[model samples]
Target: MPLDLNKLDHLIAVAEEGSLTRAAARLHLSQQALSTSVRTLEREVGVRLLERTSGGVTLLPSGAALVEDARVLRGVAQSALRRARRIGRGEREMLRIGHTPAVTGGEVSLLLRHVAVTDPELAADAHQRYPGELTAGLLAGDLDLGLCRGMSPAHGLARAVLGEHRISIGVAADHPLAGRESVALADLSEQTLVVWGRPGDSGYTDLLVGHCRAAGFEPRLERSTLQGTPPVTHVIGTDRVAFLTEPPGAAAGGAVRVLALQPPVFVPLHALYAPHLASTNRDAFLDAAQARASRHA
Candidate 1:
């Protein structure tokens, strides 16, 4: 028997909500009905999917893996329907691009400008999304492409490195290192590092931390209180220093100074997309981006 899409959706809901009651409420179905659907799905797959406990439900390894693929399947179905409707209406295709905060709006615009030079007729839309949201949007077919730095693509997604950006250091104008033209990794050993996300939780953060560790010191990391702001701005009012890609200059109205990193470190800019979905616009944009990156290299 073919796997039922509805049953898969039910399982996804249960996995997300972690409780049959809540999942059923969200789906507007009775708890018993939702439970039965999940059980049926498990039986069809010939494996136990969930572990029931007094607290709530937890996904077994197989269930977790199935949920990942189920999301991709649902997205493919939705994308197919959307494409059919667009074709029926004679609507032109527009590439939808989502990017994480780490990539910055300026970077996206720069890439788009490069794409325009190569494919002037391609219509595109770009917006910033959190890392999780970016992944979900790509998996749900809401975004045709996603741009990020150091983000590991989730299941059902593929990534390509477009290019690398040099890392710089940012410090408040009044900070001790503000007068320096450039600073080595060892110079930051004693300074508290302001990071956008928790060290272990964000791949970008981990990459930065790894650099610091390689320099022979465990970094003292502080999560920035100001979220979604430019990395250079994170050091504006604090005594902390930040790893930034922002060009060297006075930022936050001259409150911060951006300095070059000696023995330069670089981070890769990656493009993420659902490989199974074919879009001429996406292909064109990627090709243009790669060509531009090659020229820069």
Candidate 2:
């Protein structure tokens, strides 16, 4: 029988939460509505998916089998959405684009504006990610276009220089260094550094740490964290210091101040895409990226 995506999503939520009540909360439905849907789903399939107990709902063997299928079905649907967005925009059969958050906000808005003026049919969907993930996704073929930082262009993909900017230091308004319009690593010698690091084996963390050492101090790296800006945000109120891209257009949360880095360290912003794209929109997308970068420059 053809399965409903909503039904599959509902079942997965129940399985993950281990209770109809909790799953209902997650799904933003009342307990009664969730229970009724679960019952209806079971009736449709002629099986008992859950057994309610004092602890909560427990999925039966039949439900367990279907829940696994639910994940696969959802993945297929997301791919379909991406593909539809790609084709609808007048691009080719498929185009997956990725870029770091730095390049994609105002820069992205500008790109879309250009597409409206120029290539209305260039239907490319852009995904935002960090430096390493964007590159890894490009190499893995799940992504067709990418914007990355720090890494040099690889062999298989064609690259163009978008622009360059420095990674700045972010701290709380009351912090000692916040008053400085620009700063050097030596100026921060006596203060605590709230650094984001690759806790285990993250190559990105290693890159940032190496820079810290060059500045003449070892950072008190945030522990047990994955790569992202939250660790940087956490250090704001404390003695810790967080690194950032200078002159950031819009604060990710609109609360932090973007500092200027003195003796500006240049980081590459690249526009990457699969060399095989047959769509005429490839150059159009590059044009969009260049225009966007120019606006920032």
Candidate 3:
């Protein structure tokens, strides 16, 4: 049965204080009002929860059991109210965010720092997923926003192109192409291309294929899992060239080199959300993300 927590609290106070007059004074209610509240609760629960004596009041067996259960329920109700108030004050409770492999740590950290400054009570969490999985999470309501590259066309989701980043090729430092300051699409025509086929990322894959085919020869495709630090491993050990952004740096331990693509292929970074789930906090995050992307771009 649904319980009225206010009445439950009054009952607990009266039981603890052992006197109607004292309980009423502590609760800021008159004795008559306190008596009415107790009687009403008893009617609703179909049990006489208190035994009144000349000296004070005491709990019956059912009253003792209800008091114990009410203590737990009261705590839960208070916590729920606190969270609700925090939410009303502006994204100060919990914010769920999803990101793709391409979303850099710097980008996510920027947003986290902004939220900490603006709403210190906000607790932000990040879930790392492939571009496809991020998109799916946003649509399924598992995530409030997504940092991703390309996504399939869906009317249920709204996406903004946060910024465009220059595309580069990742190769072993010893590879011939790695020695060049910059390499054109034509330069990679004869080399094996390593690309991971992330689920729901067909649009991005198609773009890569179209760009390579335009250079006159089909790419020799080699696939691998792009999760975690696998990209560094693939570029370091393989003869195939992997595409990257801004190129590999010291994180590759000098084993990898990032060469700019001639003519400069620029890929768009996206911020995706469901229009129905939009909020001031979400919009603020999008604005900050876009600004950061511009700085990096």
Candidate 4:
């Protein structure tokens, strides 16, 4: 039998939220309506789909199978919708793009503008994801290109290394480091450093720590892994300092200050994509992006 898409989505939502009321709220439906839908679906399937108690609703054995099936169905539905849209627009290549957290706000907005102006017919959708996600996306054929930092491209994907984007110390306006044109890793030796990560990637974190050690001082990490741009904001708001991206103008508020690393540390930014991407119109996309970033920088 053909699957009931509506019921499948609702069931998955209910299982995830653990309460019909909350699931209904998430799905933007009345609790009564959601309950009625679930009941109707149970009757059609001729089995109890859930075991509900004050604790929360858990899927029954049969319901668990249905929920797994629902997840597959959701993926299929999303793929179908994307395919239909592409076909309708007569776009040949569905350019799925992913970028690192490094490319955000002004950088992304600017590149998108240039992409649209240069190739409006190109079916392009870009997402900001972690470095690992970008590698996976390119390998899975879901993404045409990724802008990432440090990480090498996955096999079958070639990389064009762009200039490194430096990681600088962002401090509160009144902090001591704010007065310096550039602060070396050694300068932060005794300071309480708000480094990013819980069990953060050693690859990037070690770079920072190593720099300090080389300068004959060790960094005392105050916080583990601060993802994206939050480290910049977090340091400015709370402690004396933190590690952050070097995009000076993107500092969250006027209260923040960017202190260049005294010895200067820069993170590698690479344009990664399928090996074949260099040949086609996709190569033009990179050229445009490079030009845009150059103009702004």
- TM-score: model 4 vs. ground truth: 0.56
Error of 1 at 116 (Å): 1.1
Task: Name the lDDT of candidate 2.
Answer: 0.65
Runs in model 4 deviating more than 4 A are 1-89, 92-95, 110-124, 197-202, 222-229, 247-250, 276-281, 287-297
- lDDT scores for all predictions? 0.90, 0.65, 0.73, 0.69
Candidate 1 regions exceeding 4 Å error are: none
Off by over 4 Å in 2: 1-95, 101-107, 110-122, 130-136, 152-155, 190-220, 223-234, 246-255, 277-279, 287-297
Cα lDDT of model 1 by residue, 1-297, tens digit: 998999999999999999999999999999999999999999899999999999999999999999999999999998999999988999999999998878878888888887898799989899988888999999999999999888888999999989999999999999999998899999999999988778667888888999999988999999888887766777876899998888887777999999999898999999999998868899888888988889898
TM-scores of the models, in the order given: 0.96, 0.52, 0.60, 0.56
- Tens digits of lDDT, candidate 3, 1-297: 677888998998998899999999999999999999999999999989999999999999989988866755654455456556767887453567887666665657766785466455556688777766775566555677787666653546778887776788888888877767888898887887776663335556666777788877778776665555545456786687887774534437788888878887877777788665534557777776667666776
Report the C-alpha displacement of residue 131, candidate 3, in angstroms: 3.4
**In candidate 2, what are the lDDT values of residues 49-71, reduced to their tens digit?**
88789999888999987775565
Candidate 4: count the clashes. 7
Q: Arrange candidates by lDDT, highest first: which order? A: 1, 3, 4, 2
Q: Which residue pairs show backbone clashes in model 4?
A: 183-262, 184-262, 196-224, 196-225, 196-226, 197-224, 197-225
User: TM-score of predicted model 3?
Assistant: 0.60
